[model samples]
Target chain A: MKKTLNAYSEQMNQLMGKAICLPHGPFSELHEAMRYSLNAGGKRIRPVLMQLCYEAVGGKEEIESFLMAIEMIHTYSLIHDDLPAMDDDDLRRGKPTNHMVFGEATAILAGDALLTEAFQIMLSDALRHGGLERIRAAHILSEASGMGGMIGGQILDMASENKTIDLATLDCIQLHKTGALIAAATKMGAVLGGGGSKEIAALEAYGKYIGKVFQIVDDILDAISTAEELGKPVHSDEKNEKNTYLSFYSIEESYAIAKALTDKALKLLEQIPGDTSLLAEIAETLIKRKN
Target chain B: MKKTLNAYSEQMNQLMGKAICLPHGPFSELHEAMRYSLNAGGKRIRPVLMQLCYEAVGGKEEIESFLMAIEMIHTYSLIHDDLPAMDDDDLRRGKPTNHMVFGEATAILAGDALLTEAFQIMLSDALRHGGLERIRAAHILSEASGMGGMIGGQILDMASENKTIDLATLDCIQLHKTGALIAAATKMGAVLGGGGSKEIAALEAYGKYIGKVFQIVDDILDAISTAEELGKPVHSDEKNEKNTYLSFYSIEESYAIAKALTDKALKLLEQIPGDTSLLAEIAETLIKRKN
Candidate 1:
């Protein structure tokens, strides 16, 4: 999985490189804001999960474009989440946030533009190649990104801040806030790869489990890492009194839960009736990550 | 046309009413911030256009859900546009902006939740009454709302704040920021109406013209209307030093242009085989409006 991840990062960079060339907003500042966040760089895990799952499921299409789109949406969320009115963070991906450099107004507009542009790219005939798979992919992406999924989770998380949360309540928040998108990524991959309903369902289940693990890790990392090591300011969740997985579980307990979730995700891969090794490795790599 | 419009609004509300009942997010101040702007009264112009075009094209499918989705998208844009960090406007649709009501952070999230909810409503089975038409409608809505159109125009409009814009630039801004959604509305109407290539093309052409007409009227209203009468504060364009059609063209001349564009739209409708009476009446209503 680590070897695949190295390859995945390279592919992601190449794909992001192509998408970055597309025309941006007329406002130079807004464009700069978007560029700053998008180019700041990260593990690019979302798109990688999408592409690899896509390949495992028979997604031989122009997979790069769809991957580019997921990345854009991911970038948009970060840009907005880091805004003064949102997360109020000063740094991200080892650099100043969009608002820190371009001002809040431009940062706001830039995030808005990136979000809209992500959908625009999907709607374009050039990107979709007019295939139903891509169109379906777009629909799934929208569902995952919108209120019933990531945004819904975000709302709940924001509302829950400074409030005591039970384990069940916290689990629900984490599932929607983070798990929905990760699940969507894998589902999109399976569909793109020509996987049938059963296969897609398996991948989606796989994603749901893995997505939980991802968030648990993020919560853990938030507690343990410095801004420099994590590439973003830390201690905010505690500062804002936001409860995450780590808020309730001990570090060892959180680790155990992440491992269990990863195992569940790997188990689901067997339903695909194909080579399940690659996906298990992806799940393992995710659970084992340090930064 | 008025009857059709009233019917469209009713249907859209009825459809939208169903989706929000589901527990998607924490029902708190932030969620309320979104619902406040969303459920507030306004013309469902986009839905009307979509249904109108759908019917005009011999499309008999239930498009109510998709109709609501587009309206939600439009409403979200308005909510966000009125944010302090963006337009800093105190009023929208005759009431205080979301930020004014919920605070800036919650307001931003409210707008975001609405944007996400719009897509969720469109994708869920709860709103999936139109099938293939749903996909087509989504494609149209996404493009219109995305950067290639409305968002693009927004970037231009925001950039134009306090800066003089040329006639061509102002026209382009209006064409996108305001016109794109209108175009989408009409084109969606034509598509759902079962209009073929030629009919869809004609409606789209007409849509572009009326899109211009709608903006001209708004510009005119802003210049002349009082805040009390208009609901929202008036002359906002002038206050911001933003360019408007009225600024680029003489007030009298822009009205002349509006009349001309309305006429062009009406003529295009004639060529498309739709009920010329309804189309013409709507155009005339737009051209002759007092508020």
Candidate 2:
């Protein structure tokens, strides 16, 4: 799994580098700020998931741009979420956040640039693949990343900050904030790989289950992982007075929930008639990950 | 001209309202912030131009979403530009800025949501028209709004603050910051209206010229118009220590320059075989306006 992930990461780094290259103009600082967050060396989970889902559906050829676009969106979200006005985090992926390095206004513009550039990359790449495939992929991605998905989730999380909330609200936050983008990644892979409705539906379900597992396991890791292991500080939720699965339940309970979600995802993979072993492997690794 | 602008503005308000409606959930505040900025009442110049270009190129139905998306992009840009970390404006369109009313964090998310929703609205509308049009329109809009476009221009504007820059640098700032999206609007109208390549090219040229006229006129307005007439504070560029056409030239010279650009745009309109009278009239009104 490490070898596979490294290969995907290497390819993604190259693609992202090319996508973010700005002209030697006056606004080169924007490009630099964008690259600072993008190249900060976290696991390329979203891109890898997109690729795995595409391959699982027997797709090969051109999926690099879509993968790159998804990662840009993810990176932008992280950048904005780390702003002083948002999460107020100093470090991300073991390095200073974009706002910490670039200042507040530049960080804001950098995030905005990344979000806008993601669509440009999708559209430019669409011209290569006849057009509809990239359009459909972008559609799914935009829906996931927009108010109905990630942004919506962020507002809910922000509104409920430093306050107690019910499980339903927590679910709402997690589903929109993280789950929607993950689900979009898989669904886009299915559509881009030419999978039919059935394959798309199955992969979407798999994505949803794994998304929940991913967040819960993240909570568990934050509670236990050392600073070195996690890169950033541990128990950030506690520091921020933010609610999490750990705040509501014991570590053992979080682990059980993650395990059950992973199991459900793996079972859904079985129903899809493709070589979904890579997906299953990823899901297992994701939940058990230490960093 | 008022009647024509009113009709387009009315249609745009409806489309924008529909596009921004969230599915009654935890993100209602996000929705409200977005609506506050969007409904704050601007001239809707971009959407009106887009629709005018569409009509001049003979397009009839299903352009509403594209028009709405363009306006949303414009509104999002305004919202972000008004952030305390950015332009730090207290008033926009005669009312408190998004950050003033909703807090800085929520304002930021609102801007982010509007930008994302622009794409979602385009893609959803595209699905009905077989897809490529929305993708292409989005491509133009994103390119005009991204790093090489509006955001790029903004960074340059920010970096050059309280400093003197040459004509070339100033032109670059204006082109990227304001001209690009206006150009995108007209070009999109041409493409969506089914104009051929020649017509599209002509409209693009027309858009570029009119964009210049629009900004120069705005600088003129800022220099000369009253707060009540402009609906915002006047002499803002001077207060912000920013450069403008008036900074380099007399008011008479600025007016001459705007007239020349408007004439060039009108000449381009002559090449297209559509009813461009409305576009010509708008250009004249825009350049001659007191506010």
Candidate 3:
């Protein structure tokens, strides 16, 4: 599992490095800012999940562009979420956020550039490949990132700030906020790999369960971890008065919930005929991850 | 010409009103904020250019989605440009900016939503239509709005603020910032309308010249028109210390330059073997408009 994860991560790093090469132009600073956040290390979970799902469904073609596009979307969301007008965090991954290093205006443009470039990359790929599946993948990605998905989740999260919300509402927020992209990753991978509808639906369901687990674990980490350990400010959810799993249950209870969700995700993986051992390992690792 | 322009404008308004209809969700406010700026009366110039070029190139399909998508991109740019960290303007089109009414966080999300939704609309269309031409058109739009184009131009514009830049640098900024999208409109229209490469190239040249003329006229209007006449703050270029045509030339010289560019654009139209009378009239009207 570790070997596969490492291989996928290395490939993503290489592809992303080439994806955003700085052009010899006046606006190279925008590219630099975009690279700054993108190169800042995260777990590479989304792209890895996408690759694993693609391979699990017996995908043979290279999907470097789609992998890079999903990560770009994730990175752009973080940059904007860290802006002064939003979470206003100065640190991400134990380093200065994009806005902190590049200033607000450049950071904003960097975020916009990343999002626009994601579509540009996808559309260009579609033009080259000339397939409905690629276009469908791009459409799924856009829907996940747009109003009906991440953006909508963000709005709900922002509105819910400074107040406690019920479990159903919290579920709605996390489902769209975090689950949409995760689900998109698996679903796109399945489509791009030419999986049957049943396999795609199963993986999508698997993704949703794990997305909930991921966020619950995040809330738990925020409550218990130190700033240095988490690579970001601790107790941020509390700082923003956000509702989390911790808002409704104790740490142990939250852990149990995550475990149950992971079990559910793993069960869905079993229904797939392809090799899903890597996906199962990912589900286990996500629940036990400290950061 | 006037009759055609009004017809396009009315169609655009109706389509745009339907394009962003409020979704029944917790985040309907995001939709409202998007609709606010989108419905705020700009000249609907981008979509009109797209449609005129579409007709001129003998397009016959319902391109309502692309028209709405282009306008959504334009509106999103405006919302972000008016942010406190950017131009910080309180007024746009004689109404309070998105941030002023919806607050900065929502305004930012609204901008992100519009940009994402633009692609969503386009990708959805591509899915339904299943053609390489639509995909090519979408790629053009994305490139125009991405780093090498509009956003890149924005970074140049921002860097040039509070400084005296040369005319060459100013031209680069305006060309990317404004001309890219305008050029994309005509080029995309030609492609979607099934025009040959020769016709597409000709309309693209036409669009680029008009884009330059459009920006020069904008600078002149900012220098001469009142807030009431322009429906937004005037002399804002001076306030921002940004370079414009007036920075290097007097009003008469700027007007002459715009007129010369308009003539060049009109000549480009004449080369295309299609109905270009409306395009020619648009070029002539652009150079003489008050707002």
Candidate 4:
């Protein structure tokens, strides 16, 4: 799993580096902010999920451009969510946010660029595949990263901050905010790679469960992980007084729930009728991500 | 011109209401903020241009899904631009800005929603036409509204604000800030409707010229029109102390230059070897607009 994740990290950095080097002219600051966040050294779980899902469905590693598209959308959301008016955090992924590094305005536009670039990249990537594949890819990535998906989740997350949430509310927020994108990453790979609707649904369910488990584990980590271990400031959830699963569930309770969810996700993957090692690897690996 | 414009406006309101009405959770505030800006009156120029260009190139008005998309991107830009942290405007389209109406955070997410919704609308819309056309439309809209296009121009606009800018700098800003999306609207319409490269290029040229002309006219209106007449606060150019064609050229000179650009645009439209009255009417309307 570590080796698999490392490969995605290396490829994504190179992909993001290419994006960063693109001529954004005087908007270079905007590009820099986007690059800063993109390269800020997270686990690149979404890209890996996308890659694994593709392979697990009898697909290959050649659909990298689509992975790049999904990652761009993910990066854009992070940049915006970290803005002063949103999460109001000064630190993210162990460094200053786009707004803190570039001015707020540039940061805003930088996020916008990464977002728009995602579609642009998808179109180019899909064009090679032609037909409905490009369209399918666009729709999947858009739903995951856009409103009612990542952005929608961000909206809910922002609204929920500094307030307490019940278990259901926490579940809802976590599902949409983080789970939507992660789920769509795999589902999208399936759909774009021409997997059947049944395969797509199973993959989506699997991704969703794992994504929830991942977030819950994150909450558990926040209750225990050190700043150095987590990369970003560890105490941010408490510092922000944000509503999280940890806020609602005891550490033990959350861990149990997370474990259950991970088991369920693996079970769904098992239903996919393939070797499923890659999907299993990703589910196991994501829950263990430090940063 | 009025018929097509009115037709699109009516459909847009209908679609906007439908999309917004579909529950996006407690992000209702975000949707409302999006609605506030989106529902606020404007020319509905981009989407209409897209439709008109599509129709002109033998496309269908079935492009309704894309109608909201271009508008969403445009509205999001307006919302973000009006942020106290961004352009810091109190008024837009003769009404309070989104940040003023909803808080800054809500407005930001609202803008985020609108932008995301743009893609959502595109995807569903694309599904209607099949993936190939959808991919074509998505690429066009995304690129136009993305970094190399609108956001890039906006970053330049922010950087150049209240600062001395040479003709080259000003032109770069104008091309990006305003021209890109306009060009995208026309070109995308052509692409979706099966426009040839020459036709696409012609419309592309048409869109670019008219976009610049539109901005110059906006500057002129800002200089000469009253608040009530312009529907927003006037003299904002002077207030922001931003340099524009009007600041550089006499009103009469600017008008003449605008007319010449309009002529160039219309000429390009004529070269496409098809009905271009909608574009021509739009060109004429650009010069004739009071605000």
* Top-down DockQ ranking: 3, 2, 4, 1
Predictions in order: lDDT: 0.76, 0.86, 0.92, 0.79
Work out the TM-score per prediction: 0.92, 0.96, 0.98, 0.93
Restricted to chain B, the TM-score per model reads: 0.90, 0.96, 0.98, 0.93
Give the C-alpha miss distance for residue B24 in model 3, angstroms. Answer: 2.9
Per residue, candidate 1 scores C-alpha lDDT tens digits across B22-138 of 554464555566677777766666677776777666777576666777777788788778877777888877778878888887777667766666655555532334235555656
Instruction: Give me the runs in candidate 3 sitting further than 4 Å from their true place.
Output: B1-3
Judging by DockQ against the true structure, name the best candidate: 3
How does residue A78 of candidate 2 score in lDDT? 92
Per-residue alpha-carbon lDDT of candidate 1 for residues A1-291, written as tens digits (9 for 90 to 100): 345677878778777766645454464555666667777767787888888788777666667667877888888888888888788899887788888888787777677777766766665632336446766777788878876677777778887889998988898888888888888889988988889999999899999999898889888888888987888778878888999887788999999999988888887887776666667877998877767
User: Which residue runs of candidate 2 sit more than 4 Å off their true CA positions?
Assistant: A1-3, B1-3
Model 1 residue A79 CA deviation (Å) reads 1.2
Residue pairs clashing in model 4 are B153-B177
Residue B161, candidate 2: how far off, in angstroms?
0.9
Clashes, model 1: 16
Candidate achieving the largest lDDT: 3
What residue pairs are clashing in model 3? none
